[model samples]
Target: MRLAAALISCVLCVTGTVGGAWLSRPASVDYGSLLSKASDIYAVTDERGDATRLYVVNNASNAAISRIPGAAAELPWKVNVTYSLDGPNVEANEISGASGLVGIYIDVKPQSSAANHTIPVVTFTVPTQVTGDISADNTASVATQGSDIVVAAAGNVSSGLKFSCYMDAKK
Candidate 1:
């Protein structure tokens, strides 16, 4: 009788201990910030028929760098911009030179607010000219030397726009 009682007690103790351990396991956790980089900056314009305001922010800092007026005219259905290092060295007037190139592409939905009623593809080089109207995909390339920059905008009516620019490196 004593052995059977002891056996029952042992089983109960083991079951209780196992149950307690199983119930006390740690829960899963997710700990990390979504944005964490300087190159992660992006901007988007507000809706049309309203104020022409631009919203710019950096993901790393999660802060608004600037909110300038006239930055963008209308809300683009879709906007995509990319930059790349074109060449380590370039030829300038038969002379070897080095410069950095930055490209910007914008696609704006057709809207009626301004007089021209034409979507303008502006470049850093000739900020004055309208360049021309672009299709859904507009690409503009610019090369920078110090503060000066030269830009080219290619109009894409049937297809897409393709442009290029040149810059001179500081001596």
Candidate 2:
């Protein structure tokens, strides 16, 4: 009788745990689109001084760019951005340089208004343009964390621009 009771208890515990986890899990995010949007939204390597507004544009051309088989925007620094399944936040890792270094990384995510308890809609507004040597791996990844999209980009200033920097965004 005790053995049967123990087995029943274990089964019930397992079932409840699984059910709870499933209910708590967030909806899946379309990481591919988010990654593409993130890449499309660009900021200066060191635009901390300027109050640059970062937002994603929803247009035919931008969507078409995302669908392109082999299309990627080149970044100035020798940094590589990739998608990953494991990351609570967008970040850069494995930063190194052989010929001296001054590296920087920028990550952007949804921020809710504290007073209003509402998320601000990020849309492309002003057209800001600056010129520099742009280069990238012509590659990206569609990684996610539950319903939130996350990216993992890591690189070193091995060649090209001496200073390395990277940026990320989500839609």
Best by lDDT: 1
- Positional deviation of 134 in candidate 1, in angstroms? 22
Q: List lDDT for all candidates, in order.
A: 0.32, 0.26
Runs in model 2 deviating more than 4 A are 1-138, 160-171
Q: lDDT tens digits, residues 7-93, model 2?
A: 100121111221121114459876676657553554333336663654455453635323333345322222223322123322334
Q: Per-residue alpha-carbon lDDT of model 1 for 134-164, expressed as tens digits?
A: 1222244333324433343433222333443
lDDT of 1 at 14: 14
Please report how far candidate 1 places residue 148 from its true position, in Å. 4.7
lDDT of 2 at 91: 33
The C-alpha TM-scores of every prediction are 0.24, 0.15
The runs of at least 3 residues in candidate 1 whose Cα sits more than 4 Å from the true structure, single-residue gaps closed, are 1-77, 86-117, 125-160, 166-168
lDDT for position 131 in model 1: 26
